[model samples]
Target chain A: MKALNRYARAVAELLVLFALYALGTWLAQALGWPIPGGVVGLALLLLVFALNGLKPAHLQLGAGLLMAEMLLFFIPALMSLLDYGALVRQQGLRILLVIAISTVVVMLVTAFTVDAVFRWRMRRDT
Target chain B: MTLEPMPLAWLGLTLLAYLGSRWLYRRTRIYVLSPLILVPALLLAIAAPLHTRYAEYSADTHWLMAVLGPVTVAFAVPIWQQRALLVRHWAALLLGMLAGSLASMLSSWWLARWLALDPAVALSLVPRSITTPFAMPLARDLGGVPEMTAVFVMFTGVFGAMLGGVLLRWLPLRSPLARGALFGVGAHGAGVSRAQEVGREEGTVAGLVMVLTGLLNLFAAPVLERFF
Candidate 1:
């Protein structure tokens, strides 16, 4: 009975989060915004949280639950591997190589540049 | 006798598999054993041997995917938690993200062209560095296939999550904030998760960078299409 009540509360909290996302999506559509409804929803959530309209504790349990199991959400997308069999067969090696190289390059470039700028600013301030 | 797979069954299977894999990861502390890698492989192994079609599996598991948008929205909580860091470094962080975003876009474009990939495929690759939710629509707007963009985004995420730490060690990035931003800008959600494992401040910065880079990409996609 205790476990059941906890589960019920979690479900309720998740529903509240979902409702906020739905409202954000609706508003984005209504406004004809180029941004995605979910992202708009995220922005709204951030705004509310920043302004103390909602407390972090309110979202902690539900959001943590969702984020913890986040990878499960991508299973369907991964399953789409079945659809891309042909593309994978023909250009799989090349695609893999490009992705691998580009990932490293992007990581290095972004990190180095950001660090450089930060260091330069520090030096200038001193 | 064969039994039809019900939606509840699929949901149960996914949750079980994810939990099982996650438990293994916790016990071993092995990066490769992570649910991101293990769960998909385990499901693929099961589905392949059983000859279950992707569409059928997806049909039953669609509820899991349906919650992704709301979960994404909920990321704002973490960002909100780091509100102080965001306000302090807003100017420098935004400039870094803009630079990083441009670098990602340009490198993908050049690399795709150098490999002589099809125009549509190359266009799809343009948004490969951003998160999936943002990448999908940006791909469509830029005349790229959304599906291909999704695949690319996954590839980028997996690569960053798996090998990013090693790369960071080799690079000159000593500050956690810079390392976190790099992961977020380069790897998106998976990288942010990895960053979170490192430290709270690191994770918060990475999450902020990921969201900002994604938003920047949304506006940059159209302008980028003309150049590519």
Candidate 2:
């Protein structure tokens, strides 16, 4: 019974997640909002959680379990690189070059800029 | 028009990949180089020899990617839950995100142009730091290829999560709040997840920054494209 209940909860979490996802998509499309459906639904669900008053016990298990394995969902998509191998080969050097160079650039700039802004804010506060 | 069932083929593959990643994480301590990135890259190399095309595989699986928005938005829950922290850090957070977003955009553009990449390819890289679903579609509209954009987005996620903590340690900066915010803005969903693993306070800030900047990039991207 304990195992069965756990299964049901897992299923329920997925159902709510996907339904909210679909609804968010539907609402966004219908309203022509700039935000995506999944994002909208997630936001809506968060609101519901806040208003409904969640129990730490009620949510901790489900959200934790789902999030713990979140990275798993992304794997299938990366295989798309194989289909585009030729383009990647032709553009391979450039793609790698761009990704490599831009990654460092993005990382550094992001870190520096974020640090600078915080420093500026701290100074202002004081 | 006839609609088909969600592709079981892709779903199955994702499941297998997930299993492999879990096994790896258990055996190895390389939490930084996540299974999501490594497993797929491994699958690609091994399966490429088998000639399994990405398009055919992604055809049905693309539905999975399509859910990027909700998955991303769900992150807002933790962000909202930490509303007090946000209010406290509002000034610093906003200022940091603004600088982070612009710096990310400019650096990506500069690198793209310097490499003389195809304009579309260059455009796609601009949003690589954003989550895949949002970045992929936006890249397509701006003349970037979805498949390629997907690849870079994955790479950015993996790199950010894996090296982000280690790298941040070496930097001169010293605030967990700032570090988490930077990770979210620069790395998006994956980074936010990694930030959560590191600590709750950082996770909260990172998750909020990711959502806010993702929304910002929707606008920032087009303007940056024009500038390029």
Candidate 3:
């Protein structure tokens, strides 16, 4: 009976996600592809969703909830920084610089690449 | 290791803290800043001042961080659904990733060393643009602390979400695909989420970039480590 409800569907989707991830992971390992198993799992799930008519529109509740509480998932990992506290204390400035610069670089590069692609595509079309 | 009650308690407390921060931030019209981004930061900022050691807090929360891997794996659902767009841009994406990642690594490295940062910290900083889940493990494996990487990645996310648009305007790039891809690849989760706010196409590109960038970082970090 629960399986017929929205909550049930959400759970089922999550289960399917996990199963697909395992399958993808296994397949990649078997095939010796450089890609991660989760990537493969994602591809598989995307296929199923496409064929079966499941979409982001359908998973709104679960996805919204997941996004809303997304920070909850980072807590344990945040704790891991404790191991690096000494390093941070000793070289905090350097660490800060790296993070800041890398972020800027990524942002600029992405923007440029997209811009270039768009310009190229438009030129070709003309 | 034996499963302890603290692991559960840590999760419970983290949930409480996150919810509490969300409620307070929402009521204050600070919609742009969420508890998820701020609270952990507040904890870190005030850690020494509050006399609450990260070591103590981490002892209770390590298992919670471990969940990031599985949660990341969960992203497969959205990705799977978006496969059509991915195949369409396969070649462009591949080249863009190589270019984006190489630029990111070299720039971060050059900038940090120019600023006279230590090697370990520099290593930590290299992967800040990737999602925290992937960034943390790579950071840890590369001799950077996962927690430090988490904080760094979050900072990058918050910065991207907060200032990316302003930066986007100032830049000369006119292609939405490249811009969106850069947002996702460079900013990781927050960048992608922020891109979603701009429009559908941007979000799609951002999501694609996040996936490819993650894959690239998985292999690229080891090669980059040699230079450090």
In order, how many clashes per candidate?
Answer: 0, 7, 11
Q: What's the best-to-worst order under lDDT?
A: 1, 2, 3
TM-score of each: 0.90, 0.84, 0.79
Chain A TM-score of model 2 versus the true structure?
0.77
Q: Can you write out model 2's per-residue Cα lDDT over B94-198, one digit (the tens) per residue?
A: 777777767666677777788777787777787788766567666765677766777788777776776687777788976777778767877777788778887
Task: Say which candidate scores most in DockQ.
Answer: 1
Give per-residue CA lDDT, model 1, range A1-126, as digits (tens): 999987887898799789887988899899997667778888888788868888988878888888777777766667666566677887777777777878887887778777877787788889
**Residue B165 in model 1: lDDT:** 83
- Specify the poorest-scoring 10-residue window by lDDT in model 1 chain A: A74-83
lDDT of 2 at B82: 74
List residue ranges in candidate 3 displaced over 4 A.
A1-4, A19-68, A80-90, B1-9, B24-32, B42-55, B225-228
lDDT of 1 by residue, B67-149 (tens): 77887787777778777887876766777788778777777888878887778878888888888778887888889987678
Give each prediction's DockQ, rounded to 2 decimals.
Answer: 0.62, 0.48, 0.46
Quantify how close model 3 is to the true structure by its C-alpha RMSD in Å: 4.3
- Give the Cα lDDT of each candidate: 0.79, 0.69, 0.68
- Residue A27, model 1, lDDT: 95
Poorly placed runs, candidate 2 (over 4 Å)? A46-66, A120-126, B1-10, B31-33, B193-200, B219-228
Chain A superposition TM-score, candidate 3: 0.70
Docking class of 2: acceptable
Please give the lDDT score at residue A24 for candidate 1. 81
